[model samples]
Target: EPEVTQTPSHQVTQMGQEVILRCVPISNHLYFYWYRQILGQKVEFLVSFYNNEISEKSEIFDDQFSVERPDGSNFTLKIRSTKLEDSAMYFCASSRTGNSGNTIYFGEGSWLTVV
Candidate 1:
């Protein structure tokens, strides 16, 4: 079965730099999401995209964060002016639908470290 795949499995950046994490979600899925887990924290939802626009977003998805489906297949998460607290394992996920009964598939995650 197809699964979400992320690029640059690990990344380290300066405190004020920008970071872009790339992902290719399962091809047939319609709803895409971005979630993150700080080293010792729970997985937190950041944003969800559908129909090429943000469908929902959590407070953690502040102005510094952005998501884009630049191509028909690739999904991306960008963190601007990164901070130490922004370091985490960012997961790319997708599901056929947004309904509760749908199964959400997640990528292994792209680890980000900000100095």
Candidate 2:
């Protein structure tokens, strides 16, 4: 079966530099989302996108963050400026639709480590 794939399973970055996490969501899905787990915190939704533009974004998705589908299969999240608090496991998920019954598939996660 096809699955979501994330790159650089772990990353070490400076506190003020930029970072881009990459993901390839499952094909045939229309809705894509980015979520982050800050060490012991709950998974926080950052943004949801479909049909090219953002459909919904949480307060966590501030001016420093952006996302794009660079190609048919690649979706990337860019953090303009990183912080120590930005270290977390970034997960990429995709669902065929927005319905509750649709189970979203998540990557193993890209672990971001900032210092």
Candidate 3:
């Protein structure tokens, strides 16, 4: 079995600063995604990447946000500018299939805190 792993388990940043959350998904998986959960809030989808491009994205993934697979082995999400409302536990995930009925697995998560 394989799993997604995220780095810098926790981070705190200034309101206008940028932050990049990193992740390494299961090697064989083809679909990777970024999701987040604000404290006391439900988890929400951010973006999904496949075949080296964005396959899907939620409205929450605005110009201020971007994602990339810098290398064949790792995936990353960059927040152009942090906002107090951006504080949340960001999760990296992967799936063998991206079908609606299929399941996607998640990493432990990277907690982002903004002031």
Candidate 4:
């Protein structure tokens, strides 16, 4: 089975810098999303994209954050400015159907660290 792929598995940046995490979910999946885990914290939802638009986003997705699907098969998450608190493992996920019955596939995760 095809799986989600993420580039630059790890990143290091200074506070106030910008970072971009890339992901490519299988072409068969339609809805794509970005999630994060702050070390020991639970997986947190960041944003949901469908039809090239943002369907939903959590409060954590503040003004400093943005997401894009420049290519139909690839999705990207951008942080306008990085913060020490922003250090976390970001995950790319996708689901063929956005229904309760369908399951989503998640990427390994992109680790981001800020100094």
- Name the candidate that leads on TM-score: 1
Per-residue lDDT tens digits for candidate 4, residues 7-112, read 7799999999999999999889999999999999999999999998999999999999999999777899999779999999999999999999998999999999
Error of 3 at 73 (Å): 0.7
Pairs that collide, model 2: none
| Better model by TM-score: candidate 1 vs candidate 2 | 1
| Global lDDT of each candidate | 0.97, 0.94, 0.94, 0.94
Q: Give the root-mean-square deviation of each candidate in angstroms.
A: 0.6, 0.8, 1.0, 0.7
Per-prediction TM-score to the true structure, in the order listed: 0.98, 0.96, 0.95, 0.97
RMSD of 3: 1.0
Tens digits of per-residue lDDT for model 3, 1-115: 6789999899999999999999999888889999999999999999999999999999999999999999999999999878999999999999988888777889999999999
Cα lDDT, model 4, residue 89: 97
Model 3 regions lying over 4 Å from their true place: none
Q: Kindly report which residue stretches of model 4 are placed more than 4 angstroms away from their true locations once superposed.
A: none
* Models sorted by TM-score, best on top: 1, 4, 2, 3
